[model samples]
Target: MKNILKVLRAERDWSQAVLGEKLNVSRQTINALEKGRYDPSLPLAFKISRLFERAIEEIFEDDKGEENA
Candidate 1:
């Protein structure tokens, strides 16, 4: 999946580590998500959505277009 995590974080002047702290994840996890190397779980996705005040769709995208696949 593709996501705008890096962009969003940059817009807020947040480092990956800082984002990780806010989400209670490791910095490496944030890095993986930003680099499209890992996908967040549903609960984590909701946390991200709420933190950014964006819909999950706005933050993350299903590159395969399989209805959230």
Candidate 2:
């Protein structure tokens, strides 16, 4: 999955630590998410979507190109 987490954080002028704090996660986890090294679990993904005021599909995208399926 690819997400716009870093971009959203940057837009809000939020540091990874701050974002982690808001999300009740760790800085390392934020880093991994920003780097696309990890995909968020369903619950965490919903948390992120709610925090960003965006839909899950708006934040995270499936790279499988299965939208047409």
Candidate 3:
């Protein structure tokens, strides 16, 4: 999965630590997600989409594209 987490965070002028604090996660977690080293679980993904006021589809992309990669 690829996400626009860094884009949203930067647009808000927030550090990973700041976002982590808001999302109740560690800075490292935010860093990992932003770097695409990790994909967020469903609950976390919902929290992130809510925080950004965007839909999940807007934030995260299924790199498999349509049917297959």
Highest TM-score model number: 1
Off by over 4 Å in 2: none
Backbone clashes in model 3, listed as residue pairs = none
Q: Candidate 2 — what's its lDDT? A: 0.94
Q: Pick the candidate with the highest lDDT.
A: 1
TM-score of 3: 0.91
State the lDDT of candidate 3 residue by residue for 1-69, as single tens digits: 789999999999999999999999999999999888999999999999999999999999988786685
Predicted candidate 1 versus true structure: per-residue lDDT over 1-69, tens digit per residue: 799999999999999999999999999999999999999999999999999999999999887788655
Task: Please give each candidate's TM-score.
Answer: 0.93, 0.91, 0.91
List, in order, the clash count of every candidate structure: 0, 0, 0
Residue 19 in model 1: lDDT? 98
Point out where model 3 deviates above 4 Å: 65-69
lDDT of 2 at 46: 95
Candidate 1, position 5, lDDT: 99
Q: Every model's Cα RMSD, please?
A: 2.3, 1.5, 1.4
Please, what is the whole-model Cα lDDT of each candidate in the order they appear? 0.96, 0.94, 0.94
What residue runs in model 1 are displaced by over 4 Å at the alpha carbon? 66-69
User: Residue 68 error for model 1, in Å?
Assistant: 11
Q: Which residue pairs in candidate 1 collide?
A: none
